[model samples]
Target: MEYTYYPGCSLEASSRGYDESVRFVFNALGQKLIELEDWNCCGATSYMSTKETISLVISARNLALAEKYGRDIVAPCSACYTILYKTNHILKNNPIMKAKVNQALKKDNLEYNLSLNVRHPLEVLVNDFGIEKIVSKALIRLDGVKMAQYYGCQIVRPDRGLDDKENPQMMDSLFEALGAENIYFPMKVRCCGGMLMTTYPDVALKLNKEILECAYGNGAELIVTTCPLCHVNLEAYQDKINKKFKKDFHIPILFFTQVLGLALGGTPKELGLNRNLIPFQLKKTALEATK
Candidate 1:
Protein backbone atom coordinates (compact mmCIF):
# COMPACT_ATOMS: atom_id res chain seq x y z
CA MET A 1 0.00 0.00 0.00
CA GLU A 2 1.07 3.60 -0.66
CA TYR A 3 0.07 6.95 0.80
CA THR A 4 1.04 10.63 0.54
CA TYR A 5 3.38 11.51 3.42
CA TYR A 6 3.37 14.97 5.05
CA PRO A 7 6.27 15.49 7.48
CA GLY A 8 5.50 19.13 8.32
CA CYS A 9 8.02 21.62 9.77
CA SER A 10 8.86 19.89 13.02
CA LEU A 11 9.83 16.65 11.30
CA GLU A 12 12.34 18.44 9.09
CA ALA A 13 14.22 19.95 12.05
CA SER A 14 13.41 19.29 15.73
CA SER A 15 11.77 15.90 15.17
CA ARG A 16 14.02 14.52 12.44
CA GLY A 17 14.17 11.25 14.36
CA TYR A 18 10.43 10.74 13.90
CA ASP A 19 10.72 11.33 10.16
CA GLU A 20 13.61 8.88 9.91
CA SER A 21 11.95 6.16 11.99
CA VAL A 22 8.61 6.56 10.19
CA ARG A 23 10.17 6.09 6.78
CA PHE A 24 12.36 3.25 8.04
CA VAL A 25 9.45 1.35 9.58
CA PHE A 26 7.04 1.76 6.64
CA ASN A 27 9.71 1.01 4.04
CA ALA A 28 10.75 -2.04 6.04
CA LEU A 29 7.11 -3.17 6.02
CA GLY A 30 7.11 -2.89 2.19
CA GLN A 31 4.69 0.06 2.18
CA LYS A 32 5.54 3.09 0.08
CA LEU A 33 5.29 6.57 1.66
CA ILE A 34 5.34 9.05 -1.21
CA GLU A 35 6.11 12.50 0.15
CA LEU A 36 4.10 15.46 -1.11
CA GLU A 37 6.10 17.62 -3.51
CA ASP A 38 7.03 21.05 -2.08
CA TRP A 39 4.57 20.75 0.81
CA ASN A 40 4.25 23.77 3.14
CA CYS A 41 3.66 24.11 6.84
CA CYS A 42 0.38 22.86 8.44
CA GLY A 43 -0.30 26.33 10.03
CA ALA A 44 0.25 24.82 13.48
CA THR A 45 -2.00 25.53 16.51
CA SER A 46 -1.28 29.22 16.95
CA TYR A 47 -1.99 30.13 13.31
CA MET A 48 -5.34 28.38 13.46
CA SER A 49 -6.35 30.21 16.63
CA THR A 50 -5.24 33.61 15.28
CA LYS A 51 -6.02 33.51 11.57
CA GLU A 52 -8.55 30.77 10.97
CA THR A 53 -9.02 31.50 7.28
CA ILE A 54 -5.32 31.65 6.55
CA SER A 55 -4.81 28.48 8.53
CA LEU A 56 -7.49 26.67 6.53
CA VAL A 57 -6.02 27.84 3.26
CA ILE A 58 -2.47 26.81 4.23
CA SER A 59 -3.59 23.33 5.25
CA ALA A 60 -5.83 23.10 2.17
CA ARG A 61 -2.81 23.71 -0.04
CA ASN A 62 -1.27 20.50 1.33
CA LEU A 63 -4.56 18.61 0.87
CA ALA A 64 -4.60 19.81 -2.72
CA LEU A 65 -1.17 18.28 -3.26
CA ALA A 66 -2.23 14.99 -1.67
CA GLU A 67 -5.41 14.96 -3.76
CA LYS A 68 -3.18 14.84 -6.83
CA TYR A 69 -1.86 11.46 -5.63
CA GLY A 70 -5.43 10.36 -4.93
CA ARG A 71 -4.21 8.45 -1.87
CA ASP A 72 -4.67 8.74 1.88
CA ILE A 73 -2.33 11.33 3.45
CA VAL A 74 -0.42 10.19 6.53
CA ALA A 75 0.88 12.89 8.90
CA PRO A 76 3.41 11.81 11.53
CA CYS A 77 3.21 14.87 13.74
CA SER A 78 0.19 15.23 16.03
CA ALA A 79 -0.05 18.99 15.38
CA CYS A 80 0.13 18.46 11.62
CA TYR A 81 -2.40 15.64 11.80
CA THR A 82 -4.82 17.77 13.81
CA ILE A 83 -4.44 20.84 11.58
CA LEU A 84 -4.75 18.98 8.31
CA TYR A 85 -7.65 16.85 9.59
CA LYS A 86 -9.36 19.95 10.91
CA THR A 87 -9.09 21.54 7.48
CA ASN A 88 -10.77 18.50 5.95
CA HIS A 89 -13.55 18.63 8.53
CA ILE A 90 -14.16 22.34 8.13
CA LEU A 91 -14.06 22.38 4.31
CA LYS A 92 -16.41 19.42 4.04
CA ASN A 93 -18.92 20.92 6.48
CA ASN A 94 -18.98 24.65 5.62
CA PRO A 95 -19.40 25.60 1.99
CA ILE A 96 -18.63 29.27 2.62
CA MET A 97 -15.34 28.42 4.30
CA LYS A 98 -14.52 26.02 1.52
CA ALA A 99 -15.26 28.65 -1.12
CA LYS A 100 -13.03 31.17 0.60
CA VAL A 101 -10.20 28.67 0.94
CA ASN A 102 -10.54 27.62 -2.68
CA GLN A 103 -10.64 31.26 -3.80
CA ALA A 104 -7.35 31.87 -2.04
CA LEU A 105 -5.79 28.73 -3.51
CA LYS A 106 -6.84 29.73 -7.03
CA LYS A 107 -4.12 32.39 -6.98
CA ASP A 108 -1.52 29.60 -6.76
CA ASN A 109 -3.47 27.59 -9.36
CA LEU A 110 -4.50 24.96 -6.78
CA GLU A 111 -7.82 23.60 -5.59
CA TYR A 112 -8.84 21.13 -2.87
CA ASN A 113 -12.06 19.16 -3.40
CA LEU A 114 -11.66 17.45 -0.05
CA SER A 115 -11.18 14.16 -1.91
CA LEU A 116 -8.38 12.76 0.25
CA ASN A 117 -8.27 11.23 3.70
CA VAL A 118 -5.89 12.62 6.36
CA ARG A 119 -4.59 9.85 8.62
CA HIS A 120 -2.04 9.60 11.40
CA PRO A 121 0.70 7.00 10.89
CA LEU A 122 -0.54 5.11 13.93
CA GLU A 123 -4.02 4.97 12.44
CA VAL A 124 -2.55 3.58 9.25
CA LEU A 125 -0.59 1.00 11.23
CA VAL A 126 -3.48 -0.17 13.41
CA ASN A 127 -6.51 0.44 11.16
CA ASP A 128 -5.01 0.03 7.68
CA PHE A 129 -2.32 -2.55 8.45
CA GLY A 130 -3.17 -5.03 11.18
CA ILE A 131 -1.02 -5.33 14.28
CA GLU A 132 -0.46 -9.03 13.54
CA LYS A 133 1.25 -8.16 10.27
CA ILE A 134 3.47 -5.68 12.08
CA VAL A 135 4.42 -8.29 14.65
CA SER A 136 5.11 -10.92 12.04
CA LYS A 137 7.60 -8.64 10.34
CA ALA A 138 9.36 -7.80 13.61
CA LEU A 139 12.90 -9.20 13.78
CA ILE A 140 13.65 -7.89 17.28
CA ARG A 141 11.31 -8.23 20.23
CA LEU A 142 11.05 -5.96 23.33
CA ASP A 143 10.32 -8.63 25.90
CA GLY A 144 11.33 -6.92 29.15
CA VAL A 145 11.11 -3.18 28.44
CA LYS A 146 8.26 -1.32 30.13
CA MET A 147 6.92 1.60 28.04
CA ALA A 148 4.36 4.26 28.81
CA GLN A 149 2.40 5.21 25.70
CA TYR A 150 1.78 8.94 25.73
CA TYR A 151 -0.74 10.25 23.12
CA GLY A 152 -0.91 13.91 24.17
CA CYS A 153 -4.07 15.74 22.93
CA GLN A 154 -3.90 16.52 19.22
CA ILE A 155 -4.04 13.16 17.44
CA VAL A 156 -7.35 12.04 19.00
CA ARG A 157 -9.37 15.15 19.64
CA PRO A 158 -12.11 17.31 18.05
CA ASP A 159 -12.50 15.65 14.62
CA ARG A 160 -9.27 13.68 14.26
CA GLY A 161 -10.37 10.73 16.35
CA LEU A 162 -7.59 8.18 15.78
CA ASP A 163 -8.49 5.98 18.79
CA ASP A 164 -10.31 5.92 22.10
CA LYS A 165 -9.93 9.67 22.83
CA GLU A 166 -9.63 9.49 26.57
CA ASN A 167 -7.86 6.12 26.70
CA PRO A 168 -6.06 5.34 23.45
CA GLN A 169 -4.88 1.75 22.88
CA MET A 170 -3.39 2.12 19.39
CA MET A 171 0.14 2.91 20.55
CA ASP A 172 -0.25 0.57 23.52
CA SER A 173 -1.16 -2.21 21.11
CA LEU A 174 1.96 -1.44 19.06
CA PHE A 175 4.03 -1.50 22.24
CA GLU A 176 2.60 -4.91 23.14
CA ALA A 177 3.17 -6.19 19.60
CA LEU A 178 6.85 -5.48 20.08
CA GLY A 179 6.65 -7.44 23.40
CA ALA A 180 7.14 -4.32 25.53
CA GLU A 181 5.06 -3.90 28.67
CA ASN A 182 2.53 -1.05 28.39
CA ILE A 183 2.21 0.85 31.64
CA TYR A 184 -1.21 1.98 32.89
CA PHE A 185 -1.02 5.68 32.04
CA PRO A 186 -4.32 7.54 32.43
CA MET A 187 -2.91 10.88 31.19
CA LYS A 188 -2.02 9.48 27.78
CA VAL A 189 -4.39 11.95 26.13
CA ARG A 190 -3.72 14.91 28.37
CA CYS A 191 -2.32 18.20 27.05
CA CYS A 192 1.49 18.53 27.06
CA GLY A 193 1.31 22.37 27.04
CA GLY A 194 2.46 22.49 23.36
CA MET A 195 3.84 26.02 22.60
CA LEU A 196 3.12 26.96 26.18
CA MET A 197 6.61 25.76 26.89
CA THR A 198 7.85 28.88 25.11
CA THR A 199 5.13 31.23 26.37
CA TYR A 200 4.77 30.15 29.98
CA PRO A 201 7.41 27.60 30.93
CA ASP A 202 6.43 27.51 34.57
CA VAL A 203 2.95 26.32 33.69
CA ALA A 204 4.36 23.92 31.10
CA LEU A 205 6.88 22.56 33.58
CA LYS A 206 4.16 21.99 36.16
CA LEU A 207 2.01 20.09 33.66
CA ASN A 208 5.01 18.09 32.45
CA LYS A 209 5.92 17.26 36.05
CA GLU A 210 2.54 15.64 36.56
CA ILE A 211 2.98 13.57 33.41
CA LEU A 212 6.52 12.57 34.46
CA GLU A 213 5.37 11.55 37.94
CA CYS A 214 2.59 9.48 36.46
CA ALA A 215 4.85 7.66 34.00
CA TYR A 216 7.58 7.03 36.60
CA GLY A 217 5.06 5.96 39.23
CA ASN A 218 3.64 3.38 36.80
CA GLY A 219 7.08 1.70 36.49
CA ALA A 220 7.75 2.92 32.98
CA GLU A 221 11.39 2.93 32.01
CA LEU A 222 10.66 4.93 28.85
CA ILE A 223 7.86 7.12 27.53
CA VAL A 224 6.85 6.48 23.93
CA THR A 225 4.79 9.09 22.12
CA THR A 226 3.45 9.81 18.61
CA CYS A 227 3.52 13.61 18.91
CA PRO A 228 6.73 15.61 18.51
CA LEU A 229 5.63 18.44 20.80
CA CYS A 230 4.80 16.01 23.58
CA HIS A 231 8.12 14.30 23.09
CA VAL A 232 9.93 17.65 23.30
CA ASN A 233 8.02 18.87 26.33
CA LEU A 234 8.45 15.58 28.14
CA GLU A 235 12.01 14.79 27.08
CA ALA A 236 13.54 18.25 26.75
CA TYR A 237 12.00 19.71 29.91
CA GLN A 238 12.56 16.88 32.38
CA ASP A 239 15.41 18.85 33.94
CA LYS A 240 13.16 21.88 34.40
CA ILE A 241 10.37 19.73 35.78
CA ASN A 242 12.86 18.05 38.11
CA LYS A 243 14.21 21.39 39.32
CA LYS A 244 10.67 22.68 39.90
CA PHE A 245 9.60 19.57 41.75
CA LYS A 246 12.99 18.91 43.45
CA LYS A 247 13.28 15.36 42.14
CA ASP A 248 15.36 13.47 39.61
CA PHE A 249 13.42 12.23 36.55
CA HIS A 250 15.48 10.74 33.74
CA ILE A 251 12.93 9.16 31.45
CA PRO A 252 13.89 8.98 27.79
CA ILE A 253 11.14 9.85 25.30
CA LEU A 254 10.92 8.10 21.93
CA PHE A 255 8.57 8.12 18.97
CA PHE A 256 6.48 4.98 18.41
CA THR A 257 7.99 4.58 14.94
CA GLN A 258 11.45 4.50 16.54
CA VAL A 259 10.40 1.52 18.62
CA LEU A 260 8.80 -0.12 15.59
CA GLY A 261 11.94 0.50 13.52
CA LEU A 262 14.04 -1.08 16.25
CA ALA A 263 11.72 -4.08 16.36
CA LEU A 264 12.00 -4.37 12.58
CA GLY A 265 15.74 -5.00 13.10
CA GLY A 266 17.02 -1.58 12.10
CA THR A 267 20.11 -0.36 13.96
CA PRO A 268 19.80 2.41 16.55
CA LYS A 269 21.61 4.89 14.28
CA GLU A 270 19.44 3.90 11.33
CA LEU A 271 16.34 4.80 13.35
CA GLY A 272 17.99 8.01 14.75
CA LEU A 273 17.74 6.76 18.31
CA ASN A 274 21.01 8.46 19.25
CA ARG A 275 19.52 11.88 18.45
CA ASN A 276 17.38 11.77 21.58
CA LEU A 277 18.38 14.16 24.39
CA ILE A 278 18.19 11.37 26.92
CA PRO A 279 20.31 8.40 26.03
CA PHE A 280 18.32 5.24 25.18
CA GLN A 281 20.21 1.96 25.26
CA LEU A 282 17.47 0.02 23.49
CA LYS A 283 19.87 -1.55 21.01
CA LYS A 284 22.18 -2.99 23.68
CA THR A 285 19.35 -3.62 26.19
CA ALA A 286 16.36 -4.84 24.13
CA LEU A 287 18.57 -6.95 21.86
CA GLU A 288 20.31 -8.63 24.80
CA ALA A 289 17.00 -9.21 26.56
CA THR A 290 15.47 -10.96 23.52
CA LYS A 291 18.65 -13.00 22.99
Candidate 2:
Protein backbone atom coordinates (compact mmCIF):
# COMPACT_ATOMS: atom_id res chain seq x y z
CA MET A 1 0.00 0.00 0.00
CA GLU A 2 2.55 2.60 1.11
CA TYR A 3 6.35 2.79 1.21
CA THR A 4 9.07 5.41 1.43
CA TYR A 5 11.51 5.63 -1.47
CA TYR A 6 15.18 6.53 -1.52
CA PRO A 7 16.29 7.74 -4.96
CA GLY A 8 20.04 7.73 -5.09
CA CYS A 9 22.11 10.49 -6.78
CA SER A 10 21.72 9.06 -10.28
CA LEU A 11 17.90 9.16 -10.15
CA GLU A 12 17.80 12.89 -9.34
CA ALA A 13 20.08 13.79 -12.22
CA SER A 14 21.09 11.27 -14.88
CA SER A 15 18.14 8.98 -14.10
CA ARG A 16 15.36 11.54 -13.70
CA GLY A 17 13.52 9.57 -16.31
CA TYR A 18 13.58 6.57 -14.01
CA ASP A 19 12.62 8.70 -11.03
CA GLU A 20 9.54 10.15 -12.76
CA SER A 21 8.54 6.84 -14.30
CA VAL A 22 8.69 4.86 -11.08
CA ARG A 23 6.66 7.57 -9.37
CA PHE A 24 3.98 7.50 -12.04
CA VAL A 25 3.90 3.74 -12.38
CA PHE A 26 3.56 3.05 -8.68
CA ASN A 27 1.09 5.87 -8.26
CA ALA A 28 -1.06 4.53 -11.06
CA LEU A 29 -1.07 1.13 -9.43
CA GLY A 30 -2.50 2.60 -6.22
CA GLN A 31 0.91 2.26 -4.57
CA LYS A 32 1.86 5.33 -2.58
CA LEU A 33 5.62 6.00 -2.53
CA ILE A 34 6.50 8.78 -0.10
CA GLU A 35 10.20 9.54 -0.35
CA LEU A 36 12.14 9.89 2.88
CA GLU A 37 12.41 13.48 4.07
CA ASP A 38 15.88 14.95 3.53
CA TRP A 39 17.24 11.56 2.61
CA ASN A 40 20.90 11.60 1.51
CA CYS A 41 23.01 9.39 -0.72
CA CYS A 42 23.35 5.59 -0.37
CA GLY A 43 27.12 6.10 -0.97
CA ALA A 44 26.70 3.61 -3.80
CA THR A 45 29.06 0.70 -4.48
CA SER A 46 32.08 2.99 -4.69
CA TYR A 47 31.83 4.07 -1.08
CA MET A 48 31.55 0.45 0.03
CA SER A 49 34.84 -0.38 -1.72
CA THR A 50 36.66 2.76 -0.59
CA LYS A 51 35.67 2.59 3.07
CA GLU A 52 33.18 -0.01 4.25
CA THR A 53 32.30 1.82 7.47
CA ILE A 54 31.77 5.21 5.85
CA SER A 55 29.61 3.66 3.18
CA LEU A 56 27.72 1.71 5.80
CA VAL A 57 27.16 4.88 7.80
CA ILE A 58 25.89 6.79 4.77
CA SER A 59 23.53 4.00 3.75
CA ALA A 60 22.52 3.56 7.37
CA ARG A 61 21.56 7.22 7.51
CA ASN A 62 19.08 6.68 4.69
CA LEU A 63 17.84 3.40 6.16
CA ALA A 64 17.57 5.06 9.55
CA LEU A 65 15.34 7.75 8.09
CA ALA A 66 13.05 5.13 6.64
CA GLU A 67 12.77 3.73 10.15
CA LYS A 68 11.89 7.18 11.37
CA TYR A 69 9.15 7.37 8.74
CA GLY A 70 7.83 4.00 9.97
CA ARG A 71 7.98 2.45 6.53
CA ASP A 72 10.39 0.26 4.63
CA ILE A 73 12.54 2.00 2.04
CA VAL A 74 11.93 0.93 -1.56
CA ALA A 75 14.90 1.75 -3.74
CA PRO A 76 14.57 1.41 -7.53
CA CYS A 77 18.25 1.45 -8.25
CA SER A 78 19.90 -1.96 -7.82
CA ALA A 79 23.14 -0.44 -6.59
CA CYS A 80 21.28 1.75 -4.12
CA TYR A 81 19.17 -1.17 -2.99
CA THR A 82 22.20 -3.39 -2.49
CA ILE A 83 24.15 -0.89 -0.43
CA LEU A 84 21.17 -0.01 1.72
CA TYR A 85 20.14 -3.63 2.27
CA LYS A 86 23.69 -4.78 2.96
CA THR A 87 24.22 -2.05 5.51
CA ASN A 88 20.87 -2.78 7.10
CA HIS A 89 21.79 -6.45 7.36
CA ILE A 90 25.05 -5.57 9.01
CA LEU A 91 23.37 -3.24 11.49
CA LYS A 92 20.80 -5.85 12.35
CA ASN A 93 23.16 -8.81 12.59
CA ASN A 94 26.60 -7.47 13.40
CA PRO A 95 26.70 -5.68 16.76
CA ILE A 96 30.25 -4.31 16.36
CA MET A 97 29.62 -2.79 12.93
CA LYS A 98 26.23 -1.60 14.07
CA ALA A 99 27.60 0.39 17.00
CA LYS A 100 30.38 1.90 14.88
CA VAL A 101 28.01 2.86 12.07
CA ASN A 102 25.57 4.39 14.52
CA GLN A 103 28.34 6.51 16.04
CA ALA A 104 29.45 7.73 12.60
CA LEU A 105 25.83 8.33 11.59
CA LYS A 106 25.19 10.48 14.68
CA LYS A 107 27.29 13.19 12.98
CA ASP A 108 24.15 13.77 10.92
CA ASN A 109 21.87 13.20 13.91
CA LEU A 110 20.83 9.72 12.77
CA GLU A 111 21.26 6.01 13.59
CA TYR A 112 20.56 2.68 11.91
CA ASN A 113 17.88 0.42 13.34
CA LEU A 114 16.60 -2.93 12.14
CA SER A 115 13.16 -1.39 12.63
CA LEU A 116 13.09 -0.37 8.94
CA ASN A 117 13.63 -2.72 6.00
CA VAL A 118 15.29 -1.86 2.70
CA ARG A 119 13.52 -3.20 -0.38
CA HIS A 120 13.75 -2.82 -4.11
CA PRO A 121 10.55 -1.73 -5.94
CA LEU A 122 10.51 -5.06 -7.71
CA GLU A 123 10.41 -6.84 -4.37
CA VAL A 124 7.70 -4.58 -2.97
CA LEU A 125 5.55 -5.00 -6.06
CA VAL A 126 5.40 -8.73 -5.66
CA ASN A 127 5.45 -9.00 -1.89
CA ASP A 128 3.28 -5.99 -1.10
CA PHE A 129 1.14 -5.52 -4.23
CA GLY A 130 0.88 -9.21 -5.02
CA ILE A 131 1.15 -10.77 -8.48
CA GLU A 132 -2.56 -11.13 -9.18
CA LYS A 133 -3.19 -7.51 -8.23
CA ILE A 134 -0.55 -6.23 -10.68
CA VAL A 135 -1.93 -8.46 -13.44
CA SER A 136 -5.47 -7.26 -12.84
CA LYS A 137 -4.90 -3.95 -14.65
CA ALA A 138 -2.50 -4.82 -17.42
CA LEU A 139 -3.63 -3.03 -20.59
CA ILE A 140 -0.66 -4.00 -22.70
CA ARG A 141 0.51 -7.57 -22.92
CA LEU A 142 4.28 -7.82 -23.61
CA ASP A 143 3.99 -11.39 -24.84
CA GLY A 144 4.80 -10.31 -28.38
CA VAL A 145 7.90 -8.40 -27.36
CA LYS A 146 11.08 -10.40 -26.92
CA MET A 147 13.48 -8.82 -24.45
CA ALA A 148 16.18 -9.75 -21.96
CA GLN A 149 15.56 -8.84 -18.33
CA TYR A 150 18.97 -7.97 -16.96
CA TYR A 151 19.46 -7.62 -13.19
CA GLY A 152 23.10 -6.71 -13.70
CA CYS A 153 25.32 -7.19 -10.60
CA GLN A 154 23.81 -5.58 -7.52
CA ILE A 155 20.41 -7.26 -7.35
CA VAL A 156 21.82 -10.75 -7.16
CA ARG A 157 25.45 -10.71 -6.12
CA PRO A 158 26.29 -11.37 -2.44
CA ASP A 159 22.72 -12.68 -2.51
CA ARG A 160 21.59 -9.87 -0.16
CA GLY A 161 18.96 -12.31 1.13
CA LEU A 162 16.43 -11.02 -1.45
CA ASP A 163 16.51 -14.03 -3.73
CA ASP A 164 18.89 -16.68 -4.99
CA LYS A 165 22.24 -14.94 -5.40
CA GLU A 166 23.39 -16.78 -8.48
CA ASN A 167 20.05 -17.83 -9.96
CA PRO A 168 17.60 -14.98 -9.51
CA GLN A 169 14.07 -14.88 -10.90
CA MET A 170 12.97 -11.89 -8.88
CA MET A 171 11.50 -9.89 -11.75
CA ASP A 172 10.21 -12.83 -13.76
CA SER A 173 6.83 -12.98 -12.07
CA LEU A 174 6.36 -9.25 -12.67
CA PHE A 175 7.12 -9.59 -16.37
CA GLU A 176 4.76 -12.53 -16.60
CA ALA A 177 2.14 -10.59 -14.67
CA LEU A 178 2.28 -7.95 -17.42
CA GLY A 179 2.33 -10.64 -20.14
CA ALA A 180 5.84 -9.89 -21.31
CA GLU A 181 7.89 -12.64 -22.90
CA ASN A 182 11.09 -12.90 -20.88
CA ILE A 183 13.95 -14.76 -22.49
CA TYR A 184 15.96 -16.84 -20.03
CA PHE A 185 19.40 -15.40 -20.47
CA PRO A 186 22.47 -16.53 -18.58
CA MET A 187 23.75 -12.96 -18.40
CA LYS A 188 20.79 -11.74 -16.38
CA VAL A 189 22.92 -11.43 -13.25
CA ARG A 190 26.11 -10.64 -15.10
CA CYS A 191 27.87 -7.34 -14.71
CA CYS A 192 27.20 -4.59 -17.25
CA GLY A 193 30.73 -3.41 -16.53
CA GLY A 194 29.04 -0.61 -14.59
CA MET A 195 31.87 -0.46 -12.02
CA LEU A 196 34.22 0.35 -14.88
CA MET A 197 31.84 2.87 -16.43
CA THR A 198 33.15 5.72 -14.34
CA THR A 199 36.79 4.72 -14.02
CA TYR A 200 37.19 3.18 -17.46
CA PRO A 201 34.62 4.59 -19.85
CA ASP A 202 36.02 2.80 -22.86
CA VAL A 203 35.99 -0.58 -21.15
CA ALA A 204 32.54 0.03 -19.73
CA LEU A 205 31.28 1.05 -23.13
CA LYS A 206 32.66 -2.06 -24.76
CA LEU A 207 31.24 -4.40 -22.14
CA ASN A 208 27.81 -2.76 -22.07
CA LYS A 209 27.65 -2.82 -25.84
CA GLU A 210 28.60 -6.46 -25.81
CA ILE A 211 25.73 -7.22 -23.45
CA LEU A 212 23.51 -5.47 -26.01
CA GLU A 213 24.88 -7.54 -28.88
CA CYS A 214 24.53 -10.80 -26.98
CA ALA A 215 20.95 -10.07 -26.02
CA TYR A 216 19.99 -8.89 -29.51
CA GLY A 217 21.70 -11.81 -31.16
CA ASN A 218 19.60 -14.08 -28.95
CA GLY A 219 16.38 -12.68 -30.46
CA ALA A 220 16.04 -9.78 -28.06
CA GLU A 221 14.50 -6.59 -29.41
CA LEU A 222 15.23 -4.72 -26.18
CA ILE A 223 16.86 -5.12 -22.78
CA VAL A 224 15.18 -4.31 -19.48
CA THR A 225 17.19 -3.51 -16.38
CA THR A 226 16.80 -1.97 -12.86
CA CYS A 227 19.83 -0.03 -11.70
CA PRO A 228 20.12 3.62 -12.77
CA LEU A 229 23.86 3.22 -13.09
CA CYS A 230 23.32 0.25 -15.38
CA HIS A 231 20.78 2.22 -17.40
CA VAL A 232 23.22 5.14 -17.77
CA ASN A 233 26.13 2.92 -18.70
CA LEU A 234 24.10 0.98 -21.27
CA GLU A 235 21.62 3.53 -22.65
CA ALA A 236 23.90 6.59 -22.57
CA TYR A 237 26.75 4.76 -24.26
CA GLN A 238 24.65 3.78 -27.32
CA ASP A 239 26.31 6.18 -29.74
CA LYS A 240 29.85 5.45 -28.65
CA ILE A 241 29.09 1.73 -28.63
CA ASN A 242 27.64 2.00 -32.12
CA LYS A 243 30.59 3.98 -33.41
CA LYS A 244 33.17 1.72 -31.83
CA PHE A 245 31.45 -1.43 -32.96
CA LYS A 246 30.51 0.18 -36.31
CA LYS A 247 27.13 -1.45 -36.10
CA ASP A 248 23.57 -0.16 -36.24
CA PHE A 249 22.11 -2.34 -33.54
CA HIS A 250 19.86 0.21 -31.87
CA ILE A 251 17.90 -1.92 -29.45
CA PRO A 252 16.17 0.44 -27.03
CA ILE A 253 17.06 -0.36 -23.45
CA LEU A 254 14.41 0.59 -20.88
CA PHE A 255 14.03 0.76 -17.10
CA PHE A 256 12.22 -2.15 -15.48
CA THR A 257 9.81 0.22 -13.74
CA GLN A 258 9.18 2.17 -16.95
CA VAL A 259 8.11 -1.02 -18.69
CA LEU A 260 5.94 -2.06 -15.75
CA GLY A 261 4.36 1.39 -15.78
CA LEU A 262 3.78 1.14 -19.53
CA ALA A 263 2.02 -2.22 -19.32
CA LEU A 264 -0.20 -1.03 -16.48
CA GLY A 265 -1.70 1.55 -18.92
CA GLY A 266 0.30 4.44 -17.50
CA THR A 267 1.07 7.09 -20.15
CA PRO A 268 4.46 7.16 -21.82
CA LYS A 269 5.17 10.55 -20.32
CA GLU A 270 4.10 9.43 -16.85
CA LEU A 271 6.41 6.42 -17.20
CA GLY A 272 9.19 8.73 -18.44
CA LEU A 273 9.51 6.56 -21.53
CA ASN A 274 10.57 9.60 -23.53
CA ARG A 275 13.34 10.40 -21.07
CA ASN A 276 15.74 8.09 -22.86
CA LEU A 277 18.32 9.89 -25.03
CA ILE A 278 18.59 6.90 -27.39
CA PRO A 279 15.41 7.98 -29.23
CA PHE A 280 12.88 5.12 -29.41
CA GLN A 281 10.96 6.08 -32.54
CA LEU A 282 8.58 3.06 -32.46
CA LYS A 283 4.99 3.21 -31.44
CA LYS A 284 1.79 1.03 -31.61
CA THR A 285 3.62 -2.31 -31.58
CA ALA A 286 4.71 -2.02 -27.93
CA LEU A 287 8.16 -3.48 -28.48
CA GLU A 288 9.60 -1.92 -25.32
CA ALA A 289 9.51 -4.46 -22.54
CA THR A 290 10.82 -4.68 -17.43
CA LYS A 291 13.38 -3.82 -13.76
TM-score of each: 0.97, 0.91
lDDT of 2 at 222: 75
* Each prediction's whole-model lDDT (CA): 0.89, 0.79
Q: Taking the tens digit of each residue's C-alpha lDDT, what string does model 2 give over 76-141? A: 888888888888777888999999988887887877668887788887887778878878877666
Best by TM-score: 1
In terms of lDDT, the poorest run of 10 residues in model 2 is: 282-291
Number of backbone clashes in candidate 1: 0
lDDT of 1 by residue, 54-168 (tens): 9999999999878988999999999999889889998999999999999999999999998988999998988878899999988988987898889888888874545777887
- In angstroms, give how far residue 109 of model 2 lies from its true place: 3.8
Which pairs, if any, clash in model 1?
A: none
